[model samples]
Target: MSWQTWRTALISAAATALVVGLLTDTGQPTHPTTVAQASPPASGPGTNHAIDDPLTSERTRAWREDRFGMFIHFGVYSHLEGEYTRPDGTVCRDAEWIKRQCRIPQAEYERFAAEFNPAEFDAEAIARTAKEAGQRYIVITSKHHDGYALWPTKVNRWNLRDHSSFDKNRDILAELKAATERHGIKLGFYYSIWDWNDPDAVHPSTFGRYKERMYAQLKELVDNYQPSVFWFDGEWSTDRPSNPWLTQDGEALEAYVRTLDPKIVVNNRVGKRRLVDGDTGTPEQTIPAEPVSGQLWESCMTLNGSWGYAKWDNRWKSPADLTRNLISIAGRGGNYLLNVGPDARGRIPAESVDRLRAMGSWLVRNRQADAVHGAGTPGIVAEPDWGSVSRKGDTLYASVYRWPGAGGSLTLKALSGFDVRSARVLGSTQRVAVSRSGDTVTLTPSGAPTNDIATVIAIGVAPPAPAAIGTGTGLKAEFWANRKPGGTPTVTRTDPLVNYNWKYQGSPDPTILYSGFSGRWTGFVQPRFSERYTLTTLTSNTVRLWVDDKLVVDNWQDHGPLLSSVAVDLQAGKRHKIRLDFRKESNEAVAKLLWSSPNTPEQVIPTTQLYPA
Candidate 1:
C-alpha cells in the first residue's frame, strides 16, 4: 500500500516509537532475535513480553539474536505487477496497495486473486535462499488488508484453495512452514487486522460479526499453521476518515490470538489505540539513528523500490549497499528484515535472489561478526567513514565498505582503556597492523579489501571502550526565575551538562524560578582536531547560542519541543567561548545540548573541555 495508507493508519502510534533508517523509494507515501541464552537483557516498550515472566523475555532475546530475515510482501496485487494504467497514463508505484490507491472496486480487486496463479512458487526454494542468505527467519503475508486468505479458511470461501488456482500443491503457508522447519529457520505470518473485503465491515455494529469471522480465521491459522511470529498491520483501519464507521477490536483480537498461541511473537500493530507495546517495533523503510536500547525494533525495506512485484520498477539498490545496511542495522542491535516481491508466477524476482545470495556470501565469509548472540551495540568509534563497526564478544568487526586508501590504514578514536590483542581480516589469512596511542587505535591492513560488499577485520581486544559522553565540563549558568532571558541573575550554579533532559514539578533550585524562567550559560569548548563542528540544542521554548561571538544557533521563538543546530569550523587545542540564552515560556522547561564533529559522534558536549567564561 502507499505510505499514505501506512502513515494515516499509524501516524498516531508509530510517531512515538523509534524507526531504524531504511528507505523504500516509492515517492507518494505518507505511511508510515536471538535465541535466549542467559537472562535476556531488558527490552523497551516495543515487545509484548510480560517482563514478569522468564520464558517470554527469553523468547524476545531469541528474536533479537536472529538479526537478519526475509520480508515477503506477496498478495493478489502481485498479479497486476504494475500493469494497471491510470487515466493520466501514469503507472502506479505501490503495487501492493494498488487496489486501495487506485480505488479499484472490491470486485475488481478480488478478481486479481483468480489471476494470481503462483505455479512457480516453491516453499523449499524460498526457504533455502533465505537460509543461504544468512536469514534466521522468514515473514510472509498470510492475509493482507484486502482480507484475502492464503490458507483454507472456513470463515471465508474466498481463499487461496477455493478461489484461486493455488491447489494443494500450491498451498504456500503450510508448505513454507514445513520447509522452514526442515531448514531450522523460523516462520512468521503477516496478518492484517483490518478487512476491506468483508462486506459486514462497514459500521461498528457490523464490526462485531466481522471480528468473529476474523477470530475464526486467526484460530484456524494458529491451530494448523503454527507460525512463530504474527506480524500485524492495518490496525489503524478503524473508524477514520476513509471508512468513518468501521471498527476492529485489535487488542481483544490480539488477546485471543495469544490464547491460541501465546508463544507467537506479535508486532505492535495488533491494537488500535494501544499500539507498539507489542512483541517488536516494525519500522517500515527507515532505520533509526541509534538502537532503541529499551525496545525491540526492526527496519523493513524493499529490494527494488516496491514492496510487491512491480514489473516496471527497476530501481534496485546495489548488493554492496544492501550488505552495508544489514551490517548497520545489526550493529545497532536491531534486526534487518529485507523484502522481496514475487511475481504472479510465485517466483522471487531474479534480482532479489542475486542480492540475497550476495549477502549470504558476505555473511559466510564473516561468520564471526554475524553471530546471532553476544553482539555489541552500535556507535563504535563514531562510525568511521571507511565503514562501520559490528561486535561479537570482545572483537570489533571493522566492516570496511569503502577502503580508506591503498595504504591500508584506518584510525579509531575514543577507544580508551582497552588493549588490542590482534587484528586480522576475515575471509582471508592476512594480518593487519594494530597499534594503540591512549584512546586512539590505528589499524593498518596488509592491503585493500578483497570483498566489494564488505570485508570485515576482526580486531580482538580486551573488552570494548566505555560509552563516551561529550567533551567538556557543564556550562556555567545564571537564571532568573520569574522573568525571561533579557536579563538574568536570580540563581547561579553548576551541574553536569550531558544528557540534560530535565523535568521538575517544584523548584529545581530555591534560587531559580519554579515556573517561568530565563537563563544564560557560558563556557569554553575546544575540539581535539581542526574540523567543522555541528552544535545542536533541543528546547521547550526560546533558545539562542553563540560560538566565540558568532551566533551559530538562533532559535528564539515561542515554540513547542524543537531541535536546532548550526555548524562552525574550529582549530584544535584552541578554546572557543560559547554562550547560550534560554527562556522558558511555560511552567515546564527543558534544554539539551548536543554536538558532532569529524571525531565526535552526535552526543552532548562533554565536561573535559568546558571552562567558565
Candidate 2:
C-alpha cells in the first residue's frame, strides 16, 4: 500500500504492456449521457473496450457525474488498531499492513480472524453517513490484502463466516448494498489482488490455482451483490518478487468481469492503471494540478494518513479543507473519493462523521451541490487566485476560498469577451453589482460571504462565439520528407495546424518519402484573451517549438510520445509568431501543438487564430 512500492508495480506492468502491444486507445467521446448495451467482451489480443463503445462511455460519464464518493477501509486489520507485539519483545504500529509490516507469521495473522468481530457495525448508519456527506457512491473493502473477507465467501474458509467470531450469517456487504440502495447511492467493492495468507498465490506451481480461486470469489461477490464498481488493488509486486500477475492476467480478468456484468466500472489498477488500461485512471492520495486530458480519472485520499483504523492516527482534515479539495477536483474534471477507516467495533471515528456532516451541510446551505455534480473544468475562464472554477453548461460556478473584503469587487479579467447575463451569490438573494471595464468584468456582492469555508458565486452567460477558423488561415509548412532537418525542403505548403500522427503510416504528402521525414511549421497565432497560456506539444522523435520567436519546448533528441509544455503571457488582438520543427527518426511519428489560456480550453491552435508565415 506504499506509493513507492505501487509505482514499482506500475513500471513492471507498463513494460509488459509495451512488449505485448495489447492496448491501443481509439478516441472516446468526452461526455456522453445515453445508456447503451456494451459490445460483447473483446476477444483475443486486445483490451476490453479499446474501441469507442457507447456503453462504456455512458457508464463512465455516469460515474463521473457522481463526483464524490466514500471509501471505507475495514477488515480484520482494524482489530489490531495499528499495533502488534512480537514474541521477540518488539512492537510495531501500523494500519492494514500490520501483518506484513510487523512481520507476523501467517499462522499468527490467521489467529486475529477469531477476534475480528465488528459487533457495532451498522450498515444503515454508514450508508446514511455517505448520503449526509453528499457523496453519491461508496466503495468498501470486500477483501483486503490480508486475505480477510468481510462477507461470507464459499471459495475459502478464511472468511468472516467460517473463521471470524462475528455471527456466521451476518453479511456486512449485503447489508451495505441494501442500505445504499435505500439511500439512493451506488455501492462498489474493493478487492486486493495480492494475498499474504493464501499460500497458493506464492509459489509458481500453485499460482494459477490461486488465480482460479480468486476468480471464483469475484464471481461469488458479483452474483450475490451486483456491485456497480469493482475497484481492484494490490496487483503490484511488492513483497513477492516472483509475482506471477501480468498485464495479460488483468486483461483476461477485466474481460471476464465485463462478461459477468458489462456495466460495472473498473479501475485502471486492474492492469497497470496507465494508458488504455481500465475504465478510469486512479491517482492515489493526490489531486492532479491540471486536468488529466484524454482519460477519466479519480483521486482517492484518506481522511488522515492511514487506510485502516489507527487509534493514534487522529490527523483528520478539517471540513473546510475537504470541501475545498472536492471543489478543486471538480474544477479539474475529476472525482474525489475520500476514505474513512472504521475501528474494531465497526464504528466510524466520530471526527470523520462530524467533518463529513459539516461538508454535507455546507453543500446544501450553499446550494452548489448540483454545480459540483458533473461540473467540468472552466473552459471559458482562467482559474482565479482567490478561488477555483467549475463549469456546467454556460454557467460558471466560482467557489471563492479566500474572500475579498466585504462588498469588494471580484474581478474576472478575461471575461470581457463573454456576454455575461447575470451574477449573484448562491444561497442568497444579495444583489450583486456587475460592472465592466475594457477586458474585465467585476462583481461586487452587496453583503459579506454567506459561509466561512467557500462562498459560491454563480455567473450566467450567453454562449460565447465559436472559435472558428479566420479568413486567412494556415501555417507555412516545409517538409524534408527524407532525413533530418537540412538544406532546402522537399515540399512546402500551407497547413492548418502542426498536428499529425504518422505512427502507422508515413508522409503527409504522397510525393514525399514515406519514412524518416522532417518538417517545420511557421505561423502567427492570435489570442482571444490577454492571459497566461500554457503551450503544449505531444510529439514523437525529435521536436521543438518557439512562440513569439522565443524557444518554448526544446526536445531536440529522438524520443517516443514525449509531452512538453511551457507557460507564456499573451495579449488579445495581437498576433505572435510561432514555429515548430520535428523529425521522424524511425517509427511511431506524431506531432501536435496545443494551447490553453485563462479563457480557453486546451486545443490545437485553430485555423481562425493562425496565418501563413
- Tens digits of per-residue lDDT, candidate 1, 1-613, equal 4335455533443121111111113221111111112221222211222321211256566677788889998888888885666557865445776666565544455556666788888899999999988888999998887667788776655567766666654678889999999999999888876666665555665555666676677777888878888887776643321232221244355556667777777776765322123557777777877654323678888887878898888999998888888888877667889999989888999999999998888777757435333454533355677777866667677887777676657888753345778888877777688887866779988776777877788877764333333355567777676546555477676645623322323233544544566778788877665567778776666888899898878877787646677878876677888888877676335566667653444455666766666
Question: Whole-model Cα lDDT per candidate?
Answer: 0.66, 0.75
Total clashing pairs in model 1: 38
Number of the top candidate by TM-score? 2
Off by over 4 Å in 1: 5-56, 85-94, 168-170, 237-250, 272-276, 366-374, 378-381, 464-613
Residue 61 CA displacement from its true place in model 2, Å: 2.1
**What is the TM-score (0 to 1) of candidate 2?**
0.73
